[model samples]
Target chain A: MNIVEKILARASGKSKVSPDDVVFANVDKVMMHDVSGPGVIKVFDKLQKQGISVDKLWDSTKVWVAEDHFVPSAEKVSAENIVKLSNFTKRYGIEKHFKYGMGQYGICHTISHEEAMVMPGDVYVGGDSHTNTTGALGAFACGLGHTDVAYVLLNGKIWFKVPETFYFKLNGKLPDHVMAKDFILKIIGDIGTDGGAYRTMQFGGSGIDEMSVQSRLTMCNMTTEAGAKNGIVEPDQKVFDYLTRRGATNLNLIKGDSDAEYEKIFEYEGSELEPVVAKPFSPENISVVREAPSVELDKCYIGSCTGAKYEDLEAAAKILKGRKVKIRTEILPAAISIYQRAMENGLLKIFLDAGVTVGPPTCGACCGAHMGVLAKDEICISTTNRNFPGRMGHIESQTYLSSPLVAAASAVTGKITDPRDLK
Target chain B: MDSFKNVTSIVTPLDKVNVDTDQIVPKQFLKLIQKSGFGKFLFFDWRYDENENKKPDFVLNDSKYDGSKILVTGDNFGCGSSREHAVWALLDYGFSVIIAPSFADIFFSNCFKNGILPISLDEKTVEKLQQETRPIEVDLEKQTIKTLSEEISFEIDPHKKKILLEGLDDIAQTLQYEDEITEFEKNSKIPSVL
Candidate 1:
């Protein structure tokens, strides 16, 4: 059996399970952001009115909430929603609430990783789409709607029809300057946006063993763009060590059977890849840098749960050390701890000295809630996931998705320039 | 959730593929905490200009397609972002059904939960369905879409079909399995270790 099947089988107390099996699985952890929390709270109230008053979260210790999207509330109604989350958290004795102020917590996905709230073989669900991002740690995680989240809170269980598995076998090491973002972008290009819908994408091959946990996280984060139910990699020593560093005691790992069945398999020769980017309005609209259109930009954003780790910053800082950004640029560390670490390493000073605005670690401009909203006919090259129309701001505005390395380099030139071209 | 039986309504055709949630209801309009009143904000960025006036050229704003309760869209509709607001906005805007060749997994699942029916057919069938401006009939009991030209059939998950036909939300249905879930939780054991 695949790891996802193994985990679900155990959680549902079934001796065996396969694809298309309907089961009530026990969820390990659940996360939600301010943007989606108010609706979920309303659902809870509605359920209560229906005579199912959820007096307390089934497991407050296993639940988490973070106010990242619409942080600093762009509108009064937005702030009122956060107030609702605050009132609910306080009343329910939920201790994991991360409010908008009180030291920004960035994206909920980033903080969940920073907190190490989930362990391998865990079945996790969140209210936001990118919850699949956490599966890099070897958990079976996926997104759910507000009512489903309310259900999870009420019962600590969620129902799922086990998704068929699709394997992405990354073979060799990524060539120099071509990183995980580029690699995943290329794959999404191959398999159009809906190619992986309703399926689990599991990573394997020798190349994964050599990649860092951060790189693996970067790879799995964008599976949402491919319409995957979840994306995951097997945990290794690097994962265990990172767990130990982050104060996690769960070191036990899970793996798939040597000959697990996958509905389909796709292989990639990673060493032959080029730095890639998704063109405007579609994450599946991919182009390698050398062949990319002459796209110019008004703003470049290098942040989000997708690519905001310490090393992602280091890669960006290396390109912008003494260079100045020609366009408006924002460098957001994904979490406060990452921001503090980057500051200690002087990456913040390097970016600030190089004409970059180091903003607070909210979802900032990614969701277009505020901060870096674009104007009519504006163009932005962002490291954040998803490049749908009007994703960052105006419907007329354009957004290009790329790696942080590419984002930093493009900021220096005000176009979608490759990082290798920078001095 | 209302019991879904049959519908005969004019279709609003959104031909663009990968019609994401952001395009369905952009983030700016998501500020409203309450889900109601989103009909005004549905496709807020595309339906209205920067001056807050309606754009006549847009399909939804066209008088010819007014009172459309069914949306026939291109492939991969509602692709990005998991906001259920997108579904609510469509429902509030008086669209009770959507037909596309394919849909993003979450959005398709979400429609069943919200009492909206999402029908998936082949590319040619969808193209044919969108060509006519006439009202089409969709019968949930017979599982067929009837137009002047032809009658097309599509498959749905049996479990989801049961819920939708009964006008049941997932919670109401899952509550029926309360004992099984409780029993599983009580006897659960970690599977990480060999």
Candidate 2:
């Protein structure tokens, strides 16, 4: 049994269990954003129709609500939804409501980690599928639908069929242009999108040892692409050191037992992996464009919960130090705090010097609602999740998903070109 | 909401894999909190053209899929994002069941709460069913899905099974315990009454 199995077993009050075995487990935390919160509130209203009070449901202390996407730009309906959520929070006195433009906030996933909403050995659920982001901290966190979130809000527990474990072992060092996103995209392409459905991915091996904590976070962020509930890297000194630096303490170190069983194991030599990209339509529809092509980019976006880390910014800055963006490029830091840190560290200067427009740290162009909305036939190279057509603005707009380095290089070249080619 | 027990409908096949939540219901439409009226937005990006016009090329836009109540799709359907809008949009679009070889975890659970039955069958059966364009009779009462050529029986969790059979959402189902809950509340308030 692995630590996830052990924690799940203890939480479910079971001796032991394997993948595909359905178990009712206690939820440690539930988080929702404004977009999903409103729907959950609607369900709450329906639940209360039969005379059930919202207070009698889930523990308020364990649930959190944050307004990130479309923040400050709350349209009529969304504004009303926010008001309704505010009322619910005030009525319940939940302490974790992150109002727009307040305290160490940006995207929900980044804010959750910044505020330490995730802890090791906890089963956390969020309304967005990217909730798998918290698995970087060694917790079993995954996304759920609004109704399921509503159910957890009412019951503080949910049922899950324990998924099989898939071990992704990486050896060798990643190339300069290659990072975690490329690795994950390559893995998804190899395994096919559905390969890891209803499964947990455990990343390990020497290549993982070479990855920074930020890099590990990027890798864990895309576990959803593999259709995985969560992705875990065994807690090592690097993890402990990173968490400690982030002011995290009293952390429980979790790992698989010596004899733990895995449904599938894949070994990869990271040194051999080059920059990869997932073209439109599907993440599994991947191709390795070793030599950056000359496909002109209409826009270049270099930020998201995945690619807005300080390291990601620094890497992009290094590439764009003296170059101006050829395309209309937007650089959004993950959070206000991260933005402030970049400014303090002079990374923002590098971006400004390189002619990149810096925007406030909302979801920005990631969800394609505001900021860098694309026009028909326009193509963008973004460091966000998913490259499905029309994902980032225009219905006919094409999005190419890649790493920050790839995005920065493409911004400078005005086309989808490899960073190594620019160098 | 109408009870869906024993209702039979012709199945429309959506053969694409990894039908994500975003595709099911675009984020733009998520601004509305209400569950209804999202049927039109279902597969918004896929069903529409660049001019926001309906793309005649899309399967859902085809005349054959009109009034499609049962959607049979490819494996690992609903692969991306956990937006409940996917289920809401499907239900709003008049789909009562989504039969596929496999479903994304979050989407699978969402279906149960929204009165949409997401039935996972063997790959062979899914392929076999995908070939049939004619309406397949899905008898919820008999717990069997039958086409002119083949019939297959499947099982759902007893709890979800009952919920679907009764057309009860999670809230409605939980409300059944109102009496016991109120009594327990009263007893807890006055322990001496025990």
Candidate 3:
């Protein structure tokens, strides 16, 4: 069995579990965000009216609530929703709830990764699809719906049909300036958005072993756009070391069986890969940065759970050094800790010196919630995932998804230019 | 969630592929927390121009697709983000049936929970459905789709089918194992990160 299967089998208390078998496995943790919070509580209220009263969450300790979408109150309604979520957390004694203006909160995905709340062999679920980001920690994490999350709150378990695994085997070493964002964009291009629908994408190979935990997180983070239920890397010393640093005393690493079966396998030579970008309207529509079409941008955004990591921000800052951006540029750290680290390391100063605006650690510009909303016919080169129409603003506004290296270069040039073309 | 047994209506064919959740319900409109009141904002970007006026050439704005209950779209529909608001927006816009060659996994699962029938027909059949200008009929119990010219059979998971047919939400289904969950919670590892 693979790591996903082993985790499900253990959670379900089954000796063995195979693909397509329905099982209600014990949920290790259920996460929800401000955007999805009211929906969960709405369903919870309906369930309570049905006489299924839950004074406390089924397991108060096993729940995580975050407020990032509408920080500092985007509007009256969103503020009200935050209040409702705060009240729910208070009533249920959900101690993990992190509201805005609170300490050390970034996007829910990055925060969960930084906190190491998810462990290997655990089955985790969150209301947001990007919850699969935690799978980098070697957990079977996936996304569920509002009512499904509400059900997980009432019961510590949720049903799943064991997903077939698709092995993404990477070989060779990645070139400098090429990051996991380029690797994943290339993958999404090869296998279009629906490629892994209802399946698990188990990333493997010596290349994965050598990659940083940050790169692994970015790799698993975008698997949701490919329609994968979960995207995971086998637990390695890197993950263990990271978790240990975050104060995990007893670590039980989970790995797939040596001879585990896979539904299909895709092998790539990482050395042959170059920086790639997903053109507007679809993450699947990708092109190598050098070969991209002639286009300019109204802005360049370098933030989000997928892009605003310490390494990612550092890469962007190095490129932006001694150069002023031709257009608007935003650099957001993934968390307060990451923000403080960049500030201490002078990476934030590099960005600030480059005429870039450094912002708070929120999903701020990524979701087009408030800051960085593109206007009509505007275009942006961003280090965020998803280039869908109207994702960052007006339907006519376009966004090209690229690595931080490309985003910084594009920012300096005010166009979709290649980082490799820089002097 | 509402119970769904049957739906019959004229089809609205959207020809574009990879119609993502962002286009279904844009991020800006997601501020409205309530599930309802999203009908007016369905495809808000496409349905309206920059001036907030209705676009004349949009599919949903066409006179032919007025009051359309069934939508036939290209492959890989609902392909980004897990915003359930996308599903709510579609349901609120009075769409009971969506016929596609394929759907994003999360969005497909979301359709079932929201009392909407997402029927997956092969690309050939979906293309055929797009050409028809007559009423389309869907029967969940029979798992059959009837059109002006042909009848097509569909398959759904037994659990999902039962829940949809009986109008049982996740809470209702899990309530059956309430005692089991309570016991499991009592025995499992308590979260330490909090």
Candidate 4:
């Protein structure tokens, strides 16, 4: 059996399994956020109308609620919803609720990992699609609908159709300007976005050993762009080292058998990869920025759940140490905790000395609610996910998605240019 | 609901992949949950210029796709963040059927709840559909889509098919299961606080 099969076997208490089989697996963890929590609670209310109490069904330790987007900026309706959800959390005695103004909290996807709610081999589900980001830590994580999340909230069990696995074997070393985001964009461009629907993507090969934990997280975070359910990189020394640094012990390390069967396999050499960027509106519409003339940015932002790791910060700081941002730029560390760690290590000072305004560690500008909104006719180069026009607040504004290094260099130049070219 | 033994509609073609929720309806529009009047904001960024003037380069501005009730798009039609407003905006804009090579799981499921039919076809079939400039005939009752050169039949879950055939939303469908759900809930164990 494959890794996914093994995880599902343990989850379902079954000895063996295969792809395409439907199984009811016990959920290890269930997460929700402000946007989806209210809808789920409403469904729970309907279930409660029939006298169904969920107190006995769920594991209190495994449930988490995060108020990330629109935290301080929450609209009246969503704010009321957050209040109702907080009431539910209080009634249920859930201990791991992060509210607005809480230090070390940002987007649910990024903050959950920082808070150590995820563990290797854990079967996790969140009410947001990008919950797959947790897969980078070797967990079986995916997204579900509000109804399904509500059902899990009520019963602590959810159904799944096991999917086949696709192995991506990486080789060679990535260039200075090329990073994990470019690799993912290139893969999506080659596969045309839907190539891995309902499949598990497993990253391996010598190149996996070369990538830092932060880069691997960025790689797995965008598997959703390929329409994949989840993405996993086999645990290695780097992973263990990073987890140990984060104070994670007692991790369950699981790997695929040497001869594990996979539905398909893809191979790419990192040395051949260039700095790629996803054009507006589609991750599949990718081009190497150095080659594409239409690719220009008016603003540059570097920081998000996908690009906010310590290593990511260090890389940006190294590039911007003696440089001034020609374009207005904002660099948000993933969490206030991460920012504190960077400050302790002087990474924040390097960023600040280089003229980068470090915003609060909230999911500002990523979801278009606030922070780094663009002006009309302006464009931004962002490391966050989704580059749809107006995604960063201005409807007429265009967003170009790229890696942190590219964004930093673009900030220094006030236009979309290659990081290596700045040197 | 209006009744029809047979219904057919023409579709517009926009051959771009990964049409995310933000593109369908900007996050700013999410502030209002009234679930109506979002048609004008569908594809808000791509359809409009800096001054809020319509960009003639957008497919929606093309006269040929005017009043099109169906949308034919590229593969992975809905990706990125899961915002149900994407489905709501599309439905409010008068698009009932969306044909693509594939769709994101969350967006695909959301479309069914909003009484929109999201059809997934093979790449070859999608290309063939894209080549046809004229509006194609789509018959929900027959589960068949007809073009100038070919007729394609697709399969749907029995319950989902019933809902689409009757134009019923999720709330309406759940009311049918209310009796069984209530019985199960009544006999369930009470939850305990940790």
Model 4, A1-423: lDDT tens digits are 777777776776666779988766778899987777776776666556655565553677789988766666555776776788789888888888887676556778777677777877778899888888888787888888676677677667666788899988899768877888889888888986677788898888888778877788888888887889888877767767767767789877777667788999999998899997777766777878787555446778886777776667877887888878877788888776788888999888888888778887656788887777777778888888777656787766777788888778778877667788896
Expressed as tens digits, the lDDT of each residue in A1-423 for candidate 3 is 888888888888776789999987889888998888888887776767778786767798999988877776777887888888898898888888876677777789888878778887779999998999889999999998787787788778888999999999999768887999999989989988988888999898978888999999999999998889999999889999998888776777888888888999999998899998999888999999888988877999999999999999989988999999999999888788799899999998898899999988778767888767888899999999988887787777899999999999999998787787887
lDDT of each candidate versus the true structure:
0.85, 0.81, 0.86, 0.77
Q: Per-residue lDDT tens digits of candidate 3, residues B7-116?
A: 88889999988888888988877667677888988998888887789999899999988899999998888877788899999999999889999888888888887888
- Every candidate's fraction of true contacts kept comes to 0.69, 0.61, 0.64, 0.42
Error of 3 at A241 (Å): 0.8
- State which candidate, 2 or 3, has the greater TM-score: 3
- DockQ, all models: 0.66, 0.39, 0.50, 0.28
Better of 3 and 4 by lDDT: 3
* CA error at residue B97 for candidate 4, angstroms: 3.4
lDDT of 2 by residue, A205-266 (tens): 89998888778888888888888878777767777777677787887777767898898899
Candidate 3 chain A minimal-lDDT segment of 10 residues: A97-106
Q: Where is model 3 more than 4 Å wrong at Cα?
A: B177-194
Model 1 Cα lDDT, one tens digit per residue, A1-423: 888888888877786789999988888898877877887887877778888767878888888899888877777887888888899888888888877567647688888778787788889999889999889899998998777888788788877888999899988888768878998888889988988898998887878888888888888888888889999998888888877888899467888888778999898887778898899888889988767788678999888889787778998999999889999998888888899999999999999999998888878779887888888789998899988877888778898899988988899988888888876
Clashing pairs in 4: A55-B191, A55-B192, A56-B191, A56-B192
How far does residue A40 in candidate 1 sit from its true spot (Å)? 0.4
lDDT comparison, 2 vs 4, better candidate: 2
TM-score of 4: 0.85
TM-score of each prediction? 0.97, 0.93, 0.96, 0.85
Q: Which structure among the candidates has the greatest lDDT?
A: 3
Per-model root-mean-square deviation over C-alphas: 1.7, 4.4, 2.6, 5.0
List where candidate 2 sits over 4 angstroms from the true fold. A291-293, B1-3, B49-53, B122-124, B127-133, B170-194
Residue A85's lDDT in candidate 4: 73
Candidates arranged by DockQ, highest first: 1, 3, 2, 4
CA lDDT for candidate 2:
0.81
